[model samples]
Target: MSWANILKQYEQEFKEAEVNSYTELPDGKYTVKVETARLKESKNQGIPMLAWEFVVVDGEYEGRHEWKYSLIMPERMQWLKQDLFSAGLELEELHRLEEELPSLLDRLLEIKIETKMSKNGKEYRNVYIQKVVDRTPSQKPENPFSPNNPFADDGKPINISDDDLPF
Candidate 1:
């Protein structure tokens, strides 16, 4: 209630805050969930743009966020359309697409992100949506009894010779 108490509480909150750095993750294909998709005016150019925020759903970078922006310019329209398509929308018109942009939120998309150093010498990651797919786990099933199993050949069991056996 007092100002001193408020300051102490704020300090405690800051002490408990988790620190996450902006280190660029390795360039790779990742399955991401669309956390946000919205149209906004660019700060410098005052041009309308579509901004997307995605969170990596799998891999070591899971929970890390990546962003993609598409300026609403004539030359960039095709790219915007492709981005929307990759987010699971197939509308052909920009106006219609804009109206449907909110639907992209929470969609699962496969994206290829590349890492590069910026002019300021800071590493950054760029998100490029490759396609939309079901939110399935990235792991493949293992078949221990199959011929292609690493421990045995097809139609054969792992052989344990007496000489090679570990006693």
Candidate 2:
């Protein structure tokens, strides 16, 4: 294929792409899937850190990306452990966690995003891993009020008169 033909393939995407891809997403909770996670040096002082990339799984902002960086140090171990465990990863050693980082990719997770202003008056977004979201098919009914639900609160079927509803 010629250079002109290769560029034409991405013509639609180029038109739709944002002017800058670094813009931060708004603060809110989101369901996302881990797209990338790896150990890398911090930009400021070259300290070791784990960097992550997550893409919103579904919602108005679907496909929007966010990042979370966890500094690898003794003091940060508690929070780091919480985040890792929330993503369904538990390890006895940090090295083992690093080795198993790949397992986090493609896992569904609930994340909370907050925007904060720094002392320098610059705003930044903080992403927290709230919990792992199970997307697998389960035996439980998706709707609690659906008829004949085996896991209903009572053995009897739920029946309600129109007058019972507040409307």
Candidate 3:
């Protein structure tokens, strides 16, 4: 149930069903300000590639106003090209979408984590959802978001799109 696990173990396999099917950024995407984004470049069985990231969109963030950017494997421009075309978007628009990607992409996975041991085994870190729960609150109101907030934790599960939510 931790993002650390998912990133360390299942990222590649899980991506097959996701990256292929999902090739565009949504209209209103965003990421938190405090959190930073990272990128990794690699050769996929001799194929060059890159990973663009917009980090920390699922926590008590800086109000969805920022996003980190990276161009992993620029050698593999096809991925980015296809994604932009699908969305009818441009490269700069990718950053705009990055800010909102975590929330939108969240709907595609359940809990967004797959636990696994790290190269130097010690403690398990979250790699998918990163942190499922954000204990700290950057912005708090006089009245806490009780059972009436849009994201209120009601007894029954809230309805979301199966196409975009977690497993």
Top TM-score model:
2
Candidate 3 minimal-lDDT segment of 10 residues: 104-113
Q: Once model 2 is optimally superposed onto the true structure by TM-score, how far is the C-alpha of residue 154 displaced, in angstroms?
A: 38
Cα lDDT, model 1, residue 94: 71
Say which prediction, candidate 1 or candidate 2, comes out ahead on TM-score.
2
Model 3 has a clash total of 23
Compute the lDDT of residue 80 as modeled in candidate 3. 50
lDDT of 3 by residue, 1-99 (tens): 788976878776876765445322232323322333323444444433323333434544323332222233466356555543332334554445455
| lDDT of each residue in 30-98, candidate 2, tens digit only | 999888999999988998988999999899999998889999888998988888888888888787876
- The TM-score obtained by model 2 is 0.64
Each model's TM-score?
0.63, 0.64, 0.21
Question: What's the best-to-worst order under lDDT?
Answer: 2, 1, 3
Return the candidate ranking by TM-score, descending: 2, 1, 3
Candidate 1 lDDT by residue in tens digits, 36-122: 888899999899999888899888889988888988998888888888777778886677766787777777899998888999999
Clashing pairs in 1: 147-154
Full-model lDDT for every candidate? 0.81, 0.84, 0.38
Q: What is the lDDT of residue 167 in candidate 3?
A: 71
Angstrom error at residue 160, model 3:
27
Off by over 4 Å in 3: 1-38, 43-75, 84-92, 95-100, 109-167
